[model samples]
Target: MSVDLETVKRVARLARIAVTTEDAERMTGELNAILGFVEQLDEVDVSGVDPMTSVIPMVMRKRQDAVTDGNKAADIVANAPAAEENFFLVPKVIE
Candidate 1:
């Protein structure tokens, strides 16, 4: 689809951007060029092309999905300036 200055202006407004007339014109030209390139790509033949994630096949490493008790609450709390009852203590803000 072709993008004109008016269309660019509408898009800028919808995106809550403050676009000057010069920027709107520039963006319109850029969007039109992008669409033109996409139209060019549409002419290529890819009927029997295989879908690929990468150029080379990869073997992903696997790991067991399990949970264990960390049991280091005192060690972790030692770093804090002030802690109470397994929680961080901060100054009260509300009246």
Candidate 2:
């Protein structure tokens, strides 16, 4: 895919960047070179490759799933500036 001067100008406008005529010409060449490299990558064969989360393999650490604060509602409400009926109260904003 080749990038033209008009395409470079359009891209610069869309990105909110101010580019001179000379800068646009330089950018057009650079963008075409980048697209050519991407086209080369499209020809590589990866049909047998599996998607990877990381290049190195390691086991994630596990922890117990039991709840440790199932009955601490009163303790948590005590720290609130204004709590009522086990809920935090805030100033009403709308009628």
Scored by TM-score, the top model is 2
Least accurate 10 contiguous residues by lDDT in model 2: 52-61
Give the per-residue lDDT of model 1 (tens digit) for 44-87: 99999887767898766688877854677778788888998657
Root-mean-square deviation per candidate? 5.7, 5.8
Candidate 1 C-alpha RMSD relative to the actual structure:
5.7
RMSD of 2: 5.8
TM-score of each: 0.59, 0.61
TM-score attained by model 1: 0.59
lDDT of residue 86 for candidate 2: 78
Alpha-carbon lDDT, every model: 0.89, 0.92
